[model samples]
Target: MKKTCVHLMLLVVVFCLTTIVQNRAFSELDEGLGKSLKQDSVDVWEDFLNTLDRRGLSDPHWELESEDKEKLINYFKAKIAASVSEGLTSLPERLPSYVHRFPEGMLQTLKSHAENVLKVNPHNGAAAKFLAVEAFHKVNTQISSEKYPLLEKAMVLAPNDIEICFFAYAACTRLGDQTREEALVALERMLERLRGGDHKVSYLWTVRLYTSEVAATPVQIYLKINKKHPIIDRWEVVLTEILAVFENELLQTPDSGVFNIIAYIYEAVGDIAAAQAVFKNLKPFYEKRLAENPKDRTALTSLANIHNKLGNTDLAHEYSVKVNPTLAWEGQVLPEFSPVVDLDGKPVSLADYRGELVLLDFWATWCGPCIVEMPNVKAVYEKYRDQGFEIIGISLDTDEAALRKFIKENQLPWRQVFDGKRWEGPLAQQYGVRSIPAQFLIDREGRVISVKARGKRLNALVEAEIGDTID
Candidate 1:
């Protein structure tokens, strides 16, 4: 019995010693981790301060002394080198604060930081996300071959990040000639992730995706006919896949926006029967809302527009009357505008072209539809300039350089109003120009003749009105 008691005493002594050793080790490890976290926090603050100082020098009015500039540059270089040497593992955590302080001019630095992190740890998802955003920014500025490999790498590293996946899909779609299959794969992955209940997929991103896919279908068809592009050889199959995805999305939530997109996609792909069916399905929803409230402008306008598109002109006219009873139709005199200066500091006003028919064209260089219609406008101007036809272009372009370049390249001889405030320029606001490529035709008496004149319709209207004077 004494021997057994002695054995139990030895076992208790050993257990106590082991427990004490473990407790000491854990306390030391906890201290070390706390120190590391504290150090990281300090580094993050330093990075933010440096970023702020760098940005402060970016102001056009703020001129930095050569010595100060050199010092700042060297400081940043040293910091970046240190971060790279340390593998930049903590950079992802610090990046958000740094970016919030200085959002501009940090792309290259962030790209380098992410690359360094990936070199150290290939599975760094946050680093991969930064790289993906950098690539997206690059591609949006202009299509390039550099964005794809980075996007592919990001997808492989962070397969579940919705933003990364969406960006990859965007890059693929933008450069669709070579990346159609990749786009499909990225889109599929995005949808799959969305289905997994990740609410991180934003509403705007979803809408953009739907619009891009639908828009690409028409472009692909055009390319196939014009260029015989083999990239879209299996466009029908790809379009079917896109339709399936849209149907699945609609099933999840019967959104009017999604329904509209699906209908457009169907029309673009030449599925008229399916398009009509979808439109018919949407008719009841709008009608139900209108029945609840007859004066709902949104419902009234939607019904009018859809019916007009479907050639139900009687129904369209009925809804249109309900929406606007006064009929501010063509031939009504438009509001007069005071004098505004053109880009070259020349004063212009509606009265300047009183003796001639005028076209007040509200447009912006950045607007896609406006750019697409510009050639037609130029052609019309050239054809009718000798017939006392004048154009007064009101540009909503904020970038002065781009506007000037576009005008010079296209040789747009018409006077332009450019105050550098997009959408809020004096003429744009005065004319209630909420959208671009807004056209208004003025008769020789300065009375508005047609407000919706565009393309061949504009050509016909001009020819009809000015045909008598053409001799």
Candidate 2:
């Protein structure tokens, strides 16, 4: 009995000791892990808020003045530091609420701020489109060309997002190309939900997207009849709200922002004249801003782009010169594109073959059609070698090594240039090359009479031009 009691006591002591050690170790480990997580959360939160702070959104740009801008700006710094003390899994929900709690004007500004430097990090594969569009709507115009590209990527990344696609619609119209098919798909989804009773903002936008050229009749009818109706006039309320949003910001300022959105809306609604008048007024303002800040390359570039789009070549060229004096335009009388040497550092010019009939063929290594007909090109060149015909081949091969290998293997008996820049030489831009396999059959005088000739027909056609062919 005494031995059994002693053994039982021994077991009880071992169990108590083991339990104590485990609980103490676990407590220490939990404390350490909690500290580590707190540090990580603080770092991420601070980084996220810093991005917004840089854009002047944390304190709100709309309400800034000589009095409180500095204090508010500093507060963004302080608040960002404070936010790091929170948990990560709670951030997404917390962030939206935090934004909502911001001063009325700050929400829009924050949205804009968030867009410029989206949550790009080690894991972010794309810009946050939903965040960007929410911010973009608050601004008067696009800040950069990159925004359009970002919105496009966002639409692809989140195809079901309707609000993101709405901004995408505006971006496609502004930027041109690449998003048409995808944008159409998203618009159809939005259209399925839209009713004429939803309001003019939703319905009119649907009409613009669905109807290639929106008829003026329905818009005129909407304007005349819907001004008094509550649901339909909600669009007017939105316009009013936008005005309020920009009013304080542009108040007593020389910003033609109010007019710009009105014009954009008018243009979107098929009212060309209204859009034109507003755009015309704003154009001068933008141009004047460029004049005031001669070093504002962005402002100058935008003006030049607009002019170029409008077919005002001379004005466009003039403004483009302000941003970059050397970048040549494509559609011009002089050569705008020239081939660089891929290997052997070769250089050929139109002046080199002044007396010879030059068949300047723009070819490429990646161009399948160009490759398929290269043998024929070689045969023609060989036949015309002694006939005062200079077949100067320009390979638009982007890769120097690839071009050289192709040339070496083929044993092409022709002088060629393969320095892979495109549509930027004096001769190329003059000729207006829009497609591959484009050839300029120039006479001995260096005057091109025909272009876009290919295959055996190109050789015969060139020969006929030089009075060398029987036909």
lDDT of each: 0.66, 0.52
Per-candidate clashes come to 0, 11
Local accuracy of candidate 2 as per-residue lDDT tens digits, 397-461: 66777877888899976777654566554444445454567666666666664554568786786
When summed lDDT is taken over every stretch of 10 residues in candidate 1, the lowest stretch is: 81-90
Q: How close is candidate 1 to the true structure, as a TM-score?
A: 0.53
Q: Model 2 RMSD to the real structure?
A: 18.5
Candidate 1 per-residue lDDT over residues 389-459, each given as its tens digit: 88989889889999999999989999888889887787766666667788888898888787667898888
lDDT value, residue 257 of candidate 1: 73
Give the Å error, residue 340, model 2: 8.2
Residue 148 of model 1, lDDT score: 70
Weakest lDDT window of 10 consecutive positions for candidate 2: 81-90
